[model samples]
Target: MTAVVSLVEHAPARAFPLPDTVGRALAASKILEEAAPDSYERGMWRLRAGSKVGVVAVAVPGGETVTVRITPKVPVARLFFLLGYSSDPAGWRDGMVDVAEHSELLPALAHAVERQTDRALRRGLLQGYRTVEEASLVVRGRIREAEQIRRRFGMPLPAEVAYDEFTTDIAENRILRAAVDRLLILPGVPQTVRTRLMRQRARLADITPLVRGQVIPAWRPTRLNTRYHQALHLAQVVLDGASAENLPGGLRMDGFLFDMNRVYEDFVCAALREALRPYGGRSALQAKDVHLDECDSVRLRPDFVWYADSGTPRIVADAKYKAGKRRGYPNEDLYQMLAYCTAFGLPEGHLVYAKGSAPHTSHRVRRAGTVLHQHALDLDRQPEALLAEIRELTRRMVAGVKGRI
Candidate 1:
């Protein structure tokens, strides 16, 4: 039987009587860390978890299996909401992807993926035209004259032909297949879910399995693929967030983890962008072309930036998931936003943070005369209430821009 060590996100370090191999593996992986020497305990290893939450199973020497499970600070359902909203703000609803049945993240995600994939394949696999080029006995479509002359020496037989072949082995089915396979490997998936995932894999047997490191094939949303849109989105989340790796000395590690910092940032940017749509301006997440200096030496990428129809920057904001100090949000974040304000020539900039003891506050830089606003969002709130907060925040941002004009 595999030993299990459970920890909560950002919780205090705990000591565990673990084998040296397992301890060293977890320490080297950096998914969990050893406690500082001052807090260290004798005869046991002290391990602490940060913001990453998920289950990782490490297979060490002596045929021992150790599983480390990190629970998130927020409810699993709320985390799913953040994930779904970040991926598809317009289409994602609270219960659209059912995860209420499972308490753990891995099981919940696996169940959701299985259900969505089943729905997507209910009408059978989608078929699309794939352009294929090969040497064939009979030329079906366009023939490569240059290749025919160069390789075949003008031989009439085995012509190099290119044609579009309609098949089930397309990008959509392939992604779904990859997600199913990934879940089937990870630990903690219920046997029932695993069985269903196996069936999904069988259904997608004809489709090509994705290579481990290669980019996932892209698929577009259209009327024909409307049924696949939800499944495809979830499939990508699985492919991008989960990892399986093999280490030296017969050690293997695999898990699905979510970084709260990334999740919070993505949710804030996506929600704000969706809320700002009604204001009739363009919004960008992580705008890359921005800079703080005229020489373009100091490039700055703000989490969110809104632009006017006239191609001028209207508002800029950054998202911070870190805890605020007793005074307020960190001063470093204020300095970063100030730079953004100066670069965009805006009178005000916004800093959105996860709700802490500190209330919403605004600071005016004395010399620059730029107003920097700090906004807090409570993640524990219901989906509707959380979105309403974003809508209200959008209003404040737009009002600030108008005041400047």
Candidate 2:
């Protein structure tokens, strides 16, 4: 049966009937829970990401199943860049090409996979085998083994010799093969792409199957091997959670999921850093050990903290992934931001939320000498426009700080 797959970002719940097998997979992944208890034919599921991003598949043996690729709601190109950024703080964009027109996550993933594979192939599969030293009667690596065995053993007719040699179990080949093997099982990968991957995999015929949790060797940097860096990282990301389940009917596999909170927070903090760079201030993310109480026990970790050159806190900003329209901002969020401003002795704090009905709003704390600015960023906007909004916010924040100074 054809798979029923849906690509969705972190959003509202989606309902669909799921077979017991597929339901179990989703449940294990914590992506969904049964909406209605009674009927096996009726089930509900939604995207639940806990600090991860990418494609993850859900399937059932010999039955219809759904493969949901949880990704960012932003434009496909931006999302790709963001994913690339999340993996590495720098240098992830080197091999990535322009792919904004591709909307869905699967196609984008396939495109990346194909491109990376081709790049790795062009660089030549980093092929250096490990030494496999063993004692044998038959001649192998060198006659030194036979001489050693002859000296050790009294029976000289059939000499037991120690031989030193290497096997075909290579690091680069294994990683590439693992990636290709994973792509082949991923449900929505096109036939052409799969064929390409297969060809790549076949070239690494001597490579042993990469065992789960096996440590992939980190190759040293060199001019010739630099091209393999991005592909190796991609291969690792694709093969990290690659799994296949053998059941009574058939085999099923799983894919990837990402946390929207992390994505939003990272994007905002990174953009804010770039936006604030020219202003000559310090920006720290996940600032640590902020005491909320005099006891030094209660602490708060604000997402981003901008400090003036004088070492005074200017803007304490937090990124909220939820929409304000849906149930509005939590009272705790306000209290937390307020405490951030108060603790830092700042006149105002900032809360950046994803797009909502109210794009920008502010709240003044009466008699508290503190104000809270809430700004919403539309992640769906063009990359330049999105960063521009962040820059505008930074300017206002800097101006607000300068006014007080």
Highest TM-score against the true fold, candidate: 1
**Candidate 1 stretches greater than 4 Å from native:** 33-43, 146-153
Error of 2 at 114 (Å): 1.7
- Pick out the ten consecutive residues of candidate 2 with the lowest summed lDDT: 32-41
lDDT, candidate 1, 1-405, per-residue tens: 698889988787888777766677777777864532324555477889887889999888677688889988888889988988998787887788888579888899999999999999999999998888899998798998998998899789899999999999888888999899889989999999999999999999988898889789888888899999899988988888887778777888889888888999999999999999888878989999888999999999999999988878998999998767877779999999999999999989999999977989999999889999999999999999999999999998898788868
Model 2 compared with the native: what TM-score? 0.72
Best by lDDT: 1
All-Cα superposition RMSD per candidate? 2.0, 6.4
**lDDT of candidate 2 over 1-405, digit per residue (tens):** 544645345455555555656656656545442222233334543334333445655555545656655555666676665556555544654337444345666556766766777877775567554655444566565545455555666553344444433444666667777777777777767777677777777777767876656776655545655667777766766665454544444535566544667767887888787788888879899998788888889888999998878887778999987756654565667888998987788889999988866767788998996888888888777655766787888888888888988
User: Would you give me the overall lDDT of model 2?
Assistant: 0.67
